[model samples]
Target: MPNKKNFFLTCAVLAVTLTAGCSSGADAETSEAGVDSVAESVGDAKGGSSKSPADSDTGRPRIRLDTTQFEEIRMYQGYLRCLKDHGVPISVKGNKMPEADPGTLWFPNIDVAEERPEVEKACLGKKPLHPPELDPQKNPDYMDDYSKWIACDNRRGLKVDPLPDGGGWNYKPGVTQPRNADQIDKECMIEAFGGE
Candidate 1:
């Protein structure tokens, strides 16, 4: 039950880490083009926020929408299907999305550089949008919201120790994470970050 945000962050971090090892010759341009396409679509949306910060690399404004777990799963499944359809050799089993875990959807042997263009094409509009309020660059109140999330986690038996100066937090050193850590994270995230 890890929150959608955490799951998305985990997947993004994993993707970046894995892709960093591959050669970045033409893939970089392809990836940027995909990002630009998403930015255009988001910027064109009706009633979208005008306060989105511009990306440093592309100089395009980033427009992100708050999304729920179900929405994210649906989008991810579609992207996976698209990849399969585009001959990326990924297997999409059933309709259910995989659990939000690091190794769950990981394909270690996949040649990211070779497949990157196809991935970009398939996932053009399928990237999970970040909520602006949760983005530190966009929201002045990010630290406050993060602190609330930390407090919520602690109250729920996660025992997180927040770093000083609005830095991030880590689990209390000796305390092992509970078996239901994901559930706690999910509930606390909703409590701290979800708009009422």
Candidate 2:
């Protein structure tokens, strides 16, 4: 069994892998089962909701995960702005938002655990909603879907190999990825995993 620290690290790496569509130098030995375990642990930690807030008709604000990484970064900037406006003392570097701590993706870095409630209340509507297709717990077909995502990338001329068993992909070692690779990745991700 993976320890909590390693699991959180895997989650962080997985997030980067998903966004970048390439290995972030994480262990290639990390298995699909390990990812499943992490997803299950996260679901358990969050009380195992049967329906995500996006799926529920509960009158909650829900942002889709169908956007590009650039768009998502813009949203994160808004979240940081909201936190600072709410007196969270978040630090920003030039125009970029601060990196999220592992396992607390999208949440601002608050030093005190007791401040979470206040942060949550202040940033209620700005939280990013994970689409079911992109969520391992919600989509048991996540690996297969990722394989299709690789196929989509290949179709778009990205010439990358999907990591064995579906964790991520890597560019051909000697080949230079295109200058517009980011745009291609955004389009492929939307086609492969974006939710309606």
Clashing pairs in 2: none
Distance (Å) between predicted and true CA of 29, model 1? Answer: 32
Q: Which segments of model 1 are wrong by more than 4 Å?
A: 1-8, 11-71, 86-89, 93-118, 161-170
Which is the leading candidate under lDDT?
2
Query: How well does candidate 2 match the true structure, expressed as C-alpha RMSD?
Result: 12.5
TM-score of each: 0.49, 0.47
Local accuracy of candidate 2 as per-residue lDDT tens digits, 50-111: 54332332332232444433334433444455566677766534323335332222434443
Compared with the true structure, the alpha-carbon lDDT of candidate 2 equals: 0.45
lDDT of 1 by residue, 1-196 (tens): 2212232234333222221110011111222222323333234556654332222323321222333333333334443444555666664323333444332232223544355765654354534344455567777777777788788888888777766654445567688767666556556655666643
Query: Would you list the C-alpha lDDT of every candidate in the order shown?
Result: 0.44, 0.45
